[model samples]
Target: MIIFVYDNSFEGLLTAIYEAYYTDIKPRAIVSDEYYEPNLIDNRIYIESDITKSNKVYEAIKKKISQDALRHVYHVFLSELKEAPTVIYKYLLIAFRMGYQVDFLLTNQHVLNMHKISKKVSREKHRMLGLTRFQLIKEDFYYAPIEPDYHIIGLLAPHFANRMADQHWMIHDVKRGAAAVYDKKEWFLTEVDMKLQASVGAEEELYQELWKTYFKSISISERRNPKLQKNFMPTRYWKFLTEKKQS
Candidate 1:
């Protein structure tokens, strides 16, 4: 069996796909170098990320397939599933042959799996938009921390950049040690230390207390439903919520 390994980046994945199309020997699997485990029986090839080749594959998908298919491909990449690279390659193979009709192939396992994974990533992006709560840090800047199941910090940046256009803010993905920072003009993604410290002001603390109090006061004790609450706001995300955190 032949396997292609690449840097754990979307561009690198695209470059690998581009090479698979032109190479005489096709790769049985495409995997990120970070997750790949070598086997003596399999021939492993390391693929270098090339921007020009990546762009060609990206444009080909948009042109031959559909814009929605391109979006699905990107979302699947952000899911970080171990099998995503190989699944994308197989899905694209059918997409290129069938064009837009590939989307209707619900019977095909690859196509179905691609849609399922893409929808999961999209759902998390939507939920995070509402669940994210920013706290005033050091009197001026706002910071919000999240540990989403999918890699979605980049997806959330544009919304916050437009909504908080006048303020400097950051959305940190604590799980991934990366953040989307906005400086009142543009937002950019960068790596941050996992042990990052940002002290909240006294006023911010008071505001959090007041918000918690308000949340408790507005609730009806008789109508309280723990299961329903957990359904709406998963327990994994409650650690960052001011109201959910223990006083």
Candidate 2:
């Protein structure tokens, strides 16, 4: 068995695929360095990320496949599943062989799995858009913290950019140690350890309390169903919601 190890970046994964195709050496597995475990029976091949090779592969795919197929490639990459790299490899192999119609090939297990994972990622992105709550901090910047199940800050950036076009805001992914910042015009993503002092502004605290009170006032306790509430807003996200957080 042959295993290919990459730097665990989307570009690196594409570069590995390029190398595999050019060398005519099909790998049994394609994994990132952090996830790789040494095995005596399997020969390991480490692939260095090359922008030229990655771009070549990307352009080739764009020309050979439909633009919608290209979007699926990016969405699947953002899915962040452990098996994503290998799954993308297999899915693309079938896509390139079958052309644009590969998407409708639901009977193919690889195609079906990729579609499912991408849909899960899309749902998480949609939930974050609706559930995200911003709090005004001392420096006049709005900060919203989230712990999403997937790395979806990039997916969430454009929506907030349009919604908060006049404000400087950040949507931080606390679990991933990364954030997407929008400064009234453009947006960028960064990775930094946040040393947030629990020094929330007094006005912010007042608004939070008001919002909590409003939430309480709107609730009809007699008709409340916890299971239905959970279905709409999962319990895992309660930690960051202003209304759900313990006072």
Candidate 3:
């Protein structure tokens, strides 16, 4: 069995698939280099991020699956879930096997996992949309920070761009060390050092104070259930979530 390994980027994954089809060895699995563990007899192919080959795979997927499906795939990839790459590989394999008919991915296990991941990622994306109140910095650029479990800044830029078209905004995904910036017309993502001390929103303290008050006010002394709340909002997520912090 063959193993195709690539960097974690979406383009890198595509290039691996491109190589998989062109290679003589049949693949038992296609996964990221981070997940790669060499075997005694298995064939291993290390695929690099090649723009030309990646573009070819990209175009093929675009042609086969609608733009909407591709977008959904992007969100699922950004989920950073352990099985993300495998799920994408399965979807791509089915797409190749079934041709255009693979577009009906809802029934397929691989595609369904992608859908489930997308929905989870999207719910977090939307939650951050309202929960992430931006801070006004100098130069009229609105800056906000989010440490989402997934890389969802690009997935969310269009909404803010449409809502605040006249203004410039940047949403930094602290966990991924990337930020999405939108200047009136176009949008793009960039990598940045999260280590640098970022200035806080002038109103951040006030909102935080208010957020605490609200959290306190919402409780019913007779009905409080810490166990249920923990089950719903795991403690690990509290660090980045504004509303999830302690009073």
Candidate 4:
């Protein structure tokens, strides 16, 4: 078996795909060097990320396939699944051959797997949009921390950049040690320390209390359903929710 290994960057993965397409031997797997495990039986090739080659693959996907297909490929990459590289490679091979019609190939396992994983990442992004809770750390600065299952901090940046155009804010993905920081004009993603320290002021503390109180006051005790609540607001996300915090 032959495997293509690349640096974990999206461009690197694209470069690996480009190399795979040109090579006489089709690779059985494409993986990041970070997660690669050596095997004596398997032939491994390390792919250097070339922006020119990566961009060629990127433009080809956009022009040959549909723009939506390009989006699916990116979303699947953000899933951070170990098999994501191989899945993307297979999906793109079918996409290049089938053109836009690849989306209609629901029965195809590779196509279906790509759609499922992409949808999962998209769903989490949607959930984070509503569920993210921000605390005012200082004057005009807000910070929100999330621990999503997928690498979605970058996906969430544009939404908040538009919504909070006038305020400096940050959305930190604690689980991944990465953050999307907005400086009132634009946003950028960067690596952050796992142990981020931000002090909540007295006003923010009071606001948290009021918000938690409002949450409880609006709920009808007699009709309250923990199961239903958990369905909407998963227990996994309660750690960052102001209303869900223990008062």
lDDT of 2: 0.78
Stretches of candidate 2 off by over 4 Å are 195-228
The TM-score of predicted model 4 comes to 0.86
**lDDT, model 3, position 34:** 77
Worst lDDT run of 10 residues, candidate 2, spans 219-228
Q: Tens digit of lDDT per residue, candidate 3, span 183-243? A: 6765566654434343455455644443343233233233222110664555655665657
| Tens digits of per-residue lDDT for model 4, 102-174 | 9999999999999999999999999999999988866676788899999988888888888999987767787
- Please estimate how well model 1 matches the true structure, expressed as its whole-model Cα lDDT: 0.82
What is the C-alpha local distance difference test score of each model? 0.82, 0.78, 0.68, 0.83
Predicted structure 4: lDDT: 0.83
Give one digit per residue, the lDDT tens place, for model 2 in 134-178. Answer: 987544567788999988888898889898899877777878876
Worst 10 residues of 3 by lDDT: 219-228
**lDDT tens digits, residues 1-247, model 1?**
9999999989899999999986787999999998999889889999999999999999999999999999999999999999999989999989999998899998999999999999999999999998999987544567888999999888898889999999877787888977777667667776654454435455556445434432332243432211108777899999888888775
Measured against the true structure, the TM-scores of the candidates, in listed sequence, are: 0.86, 0.85, 0.73, 0.86
Better of 1 and 3 by TM-score: 1
Q: What TM-score number comes out for model 3? A: 0.73
Candidate 1's TM-score reads: 0.86
In the order shown, the candidates' Cα RMSDs to the true structure are 10.7, 10.7, 11.6, 10.8
Over all chains combined, what TM-score does candidate 2 have?
0.85
